[model samples]
Target chain A: MNVFVLFKKEAKEQVKTYRLLIVAAVFLLFGLSTPLLFKFLPEILEMSGEGIPIEIPAFTPSDALKSYVNSLGQIGVLVAVLVAMGAIAQERERGTIIMTLSKPVGFGEFAVAKLAALVVTFLIGVALGALACFYYTTVLLGSVDVQAFLAINLLIALYFVVCLSITLMYSAFFKSQLAAGALALVTLLVMGIVSSIPPLAPYMPSALMGWGQSLAVEGGGSAWPALIISGAIIVAAVLAAWQVLSRKEL
Target chain B: MTEAIVCKGLSKRYGRLLALDNLDLHVEEKTIFGFLGPNGAGKTSALRILAGLSRATSGKAWVAGEEARLNSSVLQRRLGYLPEDPAFYNWMSANEYLTFVGELFKLPSAELAARRAELLALVDLAGAASRRIGGYSRGMKQRLGIAQALMNRPAVLLLDEPCSALDPIGRLEVLETLVKLKEQKTTVFMSSHILADVERVCDVVAVIDKGKLIVQAGVEELRQRFAHPVFELEFDQPADSAIPLLQKVPGVTRVVTENRAGGVPVLRVHVTDTAKARHGLLHAVETSNLALRRYEIVLPSLEEVFVELVANHKEQSR
Candidate 1:
């Protein structure tokens, strides 16, 4: 229970610093800027018409909105990973974990605190970006069902949480924060690649990406299995991380 | 005094290398106990076990009358430990660091603040409490380490080489603070290879070498038990005559001269016991009537005994 205090303290210390701000800024820029920038890309491509009778899809507000959402999906995952990259490794390297361990706090309490803090940070960044995307889409693409929009936002936020959980797993495994940060990013990419190969995409967390993408076409049902599995995956990853960390020597 | 700290056959192995070998230790309550060993002698490993930071490979230890292996996280709230080279969160100020440690112990807000202020002041860090620990000197860091250790008024405090990183002045201050801790009835188990620092504040000294405890006794008893009695004497005769007769004394082991002034005889005597040697020296002096100018008992310093014990162990190990 007191681990909440420790978690809150970590979260507070983290937010007061520039990490949270920078992450939000990067995602915010991606959320707000990518769609608008890509609106001109189709035009630019159509003018380039120097080859093979090239045709370009007409730029639409949905194209702009998907660009924004996809940017959030990709870079936001990176931001989440980087934000939590060293939660455990930082404490290990600084010997701060010794201080925490020397107290009544258990490894579960410590790891959970870090995991939850990252989840909350990811939620904050993605939620804000989703809000920006939602407003911009309303103005450009005309009103979609509010429910579909919120569902997509919810799915994006869930994807961000998946990244946070993976980052926590990496953070728990490495001695260097950089190792955790790098591994989390790589793991995300690997998950994406694994899902892209036929057949396996149905079960992978990265399938959530494809699921999020198809939300406009097939609605939320396309992602129900992915969402359910992502939930299962997050819990399994956290448990696996806990097992690895519980046995790890300080 | 009750035993505040006890370890029974505490064995730890780092794979093939045995860090601690069947180590048994008992430290009396309210006494400053020095846990001494050279580098890689498993001093840190032992202290870490006691602090509950690391688990033992084989055996168990107890701190403040409770078992100390695996459950040390529970013990963490009750005891304080400083690693050999304790690294702070370089990002936090000294006050911030101590407060963070205090919070980990679950000290309530007001109590935590007052305790942090008091401990910071005790280590002479009140003036620089706001300075980032990374910016502090080694001495300042060591002092802050002590303040943090004393934060909870832990019944059993374990310090791992508290003075090892400090300047001479910083060393003196930390040793003095440790002395104060002893007076406050906090049983302290401070580990170090520096005999002088141990001798300064610890009355009970436990010496571990090569992962085995060579001796664990009071500083006074250590000097009395590990070494033979020694005496320096000056007589008004040729030094050569005293050497033969001095060895002839029942308890005396060797006779070597330390000073001979203007042809006067001066000799240093190694005896098994000072009381018996005094009797023999008086008897030798009375029989020979050699005018005695200087006759004094010289006991071995802890440093000499430590070196001798470790060197002997090294020789025997090979």
Candidate 2:
């Protein structure tokens, strides 16, 4: 119940600070620009050629979806992490958490509420951005399957949650937001790199994003296990953060 | 009297640094208790443990008969804490912040609104309730912090140096609000190094030094326990003449005199019993027909007691 109350407060704060709008705008720009960027790739290459033979991939509507997913997957994860990097660090640094924690609110409640609020905000931003990209891709190149668009978008959102969790956990554990943000960025980057190895590909959460993109493109490659693992990791990270934060002195 | 707060051998440590030693404290219901200590004297640590925001490394704390640990939500419900530097979400308006705090306490909607209005008026922030906290002056922010702390109508209010950060005028404002809170019968336990503030508002006082309690008692009791009564008198008599006459009084233990450059000689009479000394001195003055310009009993100040106790504690430890 306290979590819900805190969630409401956090939601209002996100709106007041224009963080909601900024995140939505960032996602929207990516969505609107990805299709346009990919659709004119051949023309763009031809115009800038200096006798360099660039073997461009076929720019189909599927490629447009791939570009959109990759864009959201990479830049969107960063946006999500950076946006939430200050969730707990700022409160602790500014000493606002002191009075709040003195209430009947638990560390878990505070953390979960913050995560829920940001997840909703990020989800809404991603949905709007994805819709814009989906519309432009359909009109410019060709039609995209509605089911695949929804499924792929959901997978990318899950990835965003993972990044958000990492950022928030560090924010609770570290005193400085910059340190937390850097650590989260490094952790995600390392995971992303390591998960690409052939042996680890099936078990890694990053593989879910690849599977989602592939399915959207050629309607193949299931990543159900990876999706479940990523979801589990997110939950674990949040719990660990709560435990650490509960032990923290002021 | 019912115990509003109790700490039994509470201790806190950070690695090798012992922030709080084994400490015991008791606060009765509806009393304004002042925790007096210099900076880094572990006052905040004790308050935080009682507030349930931090845990003691050893020992235990209780609030309103409930165990108070870091995760003790039940006890937390009955405790209102204002940290040394109370911080708020700068973007939030005062009304919004108070509402947020009320929501955390799970107050019902109707009661929450009513309480909010009452608290805003109590702290004199009703006019600026809609202004963002970031735009608020330090005093306004402090008042808002106090309002939020009282939103739950907590059984015990723990304030860590509420007036230490304010200007003189701002300090007076907060002190005034606290005075009104006292009338509401809230059990207020505040920590401060500012002796005058504590002396003004506190019914009970505890002096702590270097992770140890130097003394804890009612303000009047502490003064009586550690301070001696001394009376200062100004007359036309010289030091040699005044000393013998004052010393001859029955309850007067000793008398010393100092001659000012261009004024009358002053006599300080140390007394064993103030009542006996007062009667004897007045009788002697009247009988002698002494032109008494000034005769005043110098009651010991809390500052003197605090300094003596802390200095003695430091010397003993050394």
Candidate 3:
């Protein structure tokens, strides 16, 4: 009950701060632009041409879908990090956590409640963004495969969950909001760079985003191992955050 | 009387700094217990340990017969704490924040609303209940902090410097609120360096210095134990001659003269026995050329007792 109450407060905070609106607007813009950019690229280039004939690759609906997934995997992850980087760090810095945790709520419950709130908001924002992309992909280009589109979006959502959890983990561990954000972005970038290597490709979380892009572009790859690894890491991050925060002097 | 809160050798060390050093404290139920100390005197460290926000390095504490620790949900439910600098979500109004806190305590909806209204009125914040906390003054925030702490009606309320950041009016308002809580038999353990504020509201006070307990006694007992008996005499004429005459009388320990607002000299007689000094002073004034305007016996205030106790403790430690 305490966890649910805390979750509600955090969700309300997100709404009050207009984080939900900012994320939704950013993702919706990505959704609208991804398809429109590809459809008009040849003509846009023609307008800037120097009279030399340029051969443009025949663009397909899959290209637009692939672009949408790529944008979410890259820019969408950044947006998630931006929204979640201050979830705990700001409260701790401001000494607000001292009052709230002085009640009957456990640190584990507090950490989990915050995580759940951000995840729920992230999921909703991503779903709405995915809907916008799907609508544009079908109307501007040819018809998209519904199953393949859902699968790619789901995989991308999992990738986003990993990003959000890492942001939360660093936010709990660090006292400075800017330091938490910098460290979370650095850690995610290192993970992405290291996971793309041939040896670690199958077991790394960063591969999930690539696999999501592949699925969207009709280049198939197994997402199960990355899914399992990312899921375990998410659990580990939440648990570690709870442990560190519970032992904190505040 | 029952012990609402107890700490046994409660010690907290932050790396090399000893925040609390083997401190033991007992707060009886239904009493306003004042934890008094200067800054860095470990008053806050002890209260935080009892509130279960921070752990003691080597000791244990209990609140309401249960061990005090963050993991004990049952124990936390019976304890309410207002931090030295109480902070809240600025985005929330006073009403919304208290409601959120009540929900965390899992209060029934109807009961929560009733208690919220009662506490808002108690803190004199009902009129501003709908305003965001960001717009509140420091005193307003302190009052709302108290209201939130009382929402659960816990067995005990731990306040750290509850009136430290308030103006005189704000301080008086908060003290009055705590005085009202005494009727409900709420055990309040509040810490402050403001001796006058403690003297006004707390029945019992424990003075701590250098992370150790110096003295623990009732306000009256503290005055009787550590304070000296004093008498003040205002003379229409210069009392320089009367000092020698007064000091000659037995039981009159020391005499000092000062000039009042109108340049009139007043004699302050430190006495060992008030009854003996009363007659001796009156007779001396009549016999001498000094014309006495008024003679009054002054009991020691808590401020004097606190200073004497802290100074004695410092000297003993040295």
Candidate 4:
């Protein structure tokens, strides 16, 4: 119940701070542009007048959606880290954590409430982006497989959840937002590198992005290990943040 | 009286520096207790431990009959704490912040609303409750800090330098509010270095220096225990000649002449024995043929006792 109250406050803070607006705008821009860019690349390149005529294949919905997944995988991760890196560090720096935690708020509840609010904000952003992408792909290109599109977006959202939780954990560890953000980005970059190795691809969080791209381009293989591991990482990161905050001398 | 707050051998250390060294304190219910110390004297450290925001390296504390541990919801619910420099969400209005705090305590909706209004009015912030907190002055923020701490009517209220950011009028208002909390049987344990404010409202005070307890007693009792008796004498003429005679008197520890503007010189006689020094001082004045204008024994202020206690502690530690 206390978590509910804190969640409401955290959500309101996201809205009032314009973080929600910034996130939605970023996602919406990528969503609208990914399909439009895929459809008009030939014309755009011809206009550039490179002196040599290059052979361009016909644009497909799979190409547009796959590009969307890849764009979100790179730029979306940056947005997640930026949004969450200050969630705890800024509160501690400003002395607001002392005020909020001085009440009857459990450290776990405080951490979980923040994570839950961020999750909702990202979910909304992902939904809007997916809707725009779907609408554009159907209008400007061919129709997309609705189920595959939904699965791909869900995977993308889960990938972002992993990024946010890890960033929040670093935010709890350090008082400087810059340090937290840099460290979170480094950790995610390491994971992205590890996911490219064939032996470790199934176990890494970045595999979720690969899994989403595969769902969009191909048909049906499941990265069950990656899905389960991503879920575990999210839970573990939130719990680590809670433990760090509980022991901290706010 | 029941002890609303108690600490047994509480100590804290950061690396080689000892912030709090085996400090013990007992604060009774329904009293305004002052925790006085110089900067870095471990006053904030002890308060943080009692407030359950930080853990002590050793020893234990209890507030309102519950053990005070870091992040204990049960303990947190029973008490309220106001940090030295309270921060708020800049975008939030006073009304919004108070409502958010009240909800954190799980207060009923109707009660939360009424309590928010009452607290805003109590802090004289009702007129600007709707304004963003980012625009508030430091004094206004301090008052809001006080108001939020009292939202739950806590059994024990711990404040760290509650009035440090306030002006004279704001300080008086907060002091008066503390007095009212005592009347309502809420124990307020406030830490501050402002001796005059502590002297005015605190029923009991504990003075600490160098992370160790110097003295703990009632305000008047502290003055009585640690302060030396002093006599202020005004003479019709220069008392420079009388100083040597007064120094010769038994029980007179020190004597100094105070020069007043457009008036005759005065002598302050500090003594260990008031009775013997009183008689001897008068005899010494008469023998020197100095005509006395006024003679009065002055009670020492808390500032004097505090300075003496800290100075003596420093001397003894050396």
Task: Tell me what fraction of the real C-alpha contacts between chains A and B each candidate also makes.
Answer: 0.55, 0.88, 0.83, 0.93
lDDT sort, best first: 4, 3, 2, 1
Model 2 chain A, TM-score vs. native: 0.93
> Which residue segments of model 1 deviate by more than 4 Å?
A40-58, A140-145, A217-221, B71-73, B228-297
Off by over 4 Å in 2: A45-58, B229-297
Local accuracy of candidate 3 as per-residue lDDT tens digits, A208-242 = 87787787776587768889999998999899889
> Model 1 misses residue A121 by how many Å?
1.6
lDDT of 2 by residue, B119-143 (tens): 9998889999998899988778887
Using lDDT as the yardstick, the better of models 1 and 2 is: 2
- For model 4, residues B1-318, the per-residue Cα lDDT tens digits are 899999999999988989999999999999999999989999999988888899999999999999989988899899989999999999999999999999998899999999999999889999999999999999999999998899999999999999999899999999999999999999999998788999999999999997899889999999889999889999887889889999999999888777889777778888989998888988998899988999999997898789889989999999
Q: Is candidate 1 or candidate 4 better by DockQ?
A: 4
Model 2 scores a C-alpha lDDT of 0.86
Looking at model 4, residue B244 earns an lDDT score of 91
Q: Could you tell which candidate, 1 or 3, scores higher by DockQ?
A: 3
Which residues of candidate 3, in runs, are more than 4 Å off? B231-295
Tens digit of lDDT per residue, candidate 1, span A1-250?
Answer: 4687778777876776666678767767776675556555666665787654656665555566556667777677777887777888877877777766776777777778877777777667777776776666566555545666667667887888888888888888888989899888888888888888788878777666666666654455575677898898788778867776667778
Task: List, residue by residue over B219-261, the lDDT tens digit for candidate 3.
Answer: 9999998888888899787778888888887798778776779
TM-score of chain B of 1: 0.81
Clashes of 1: 0
lDDT for each residue of candidate 1 in B1-318, tens digit (9 for 90 to 100) = 788888889988887899999999988999999888767888888888898877888777888877886535567767888877777777689888888778777789999999998998899999999987879887888888778888888999998888888888888988888888888999988888778888878888888887999888888888877877678888666656556777888888777766544876568787877777788877876676577887888886788678767877888889
Candidate order by decreasing TM-score: 4, 3, 2, 1
Worst 10 residues of 2 chain B by lDDT: B236-245
Reference-based TM-score, model 3: 0.91
In the order shown, the candidates' DockQ scores are: 0.38, 0.65, 0.68, 0.76
**Evaluated with lDDT, which candidate comes out highest?**
4
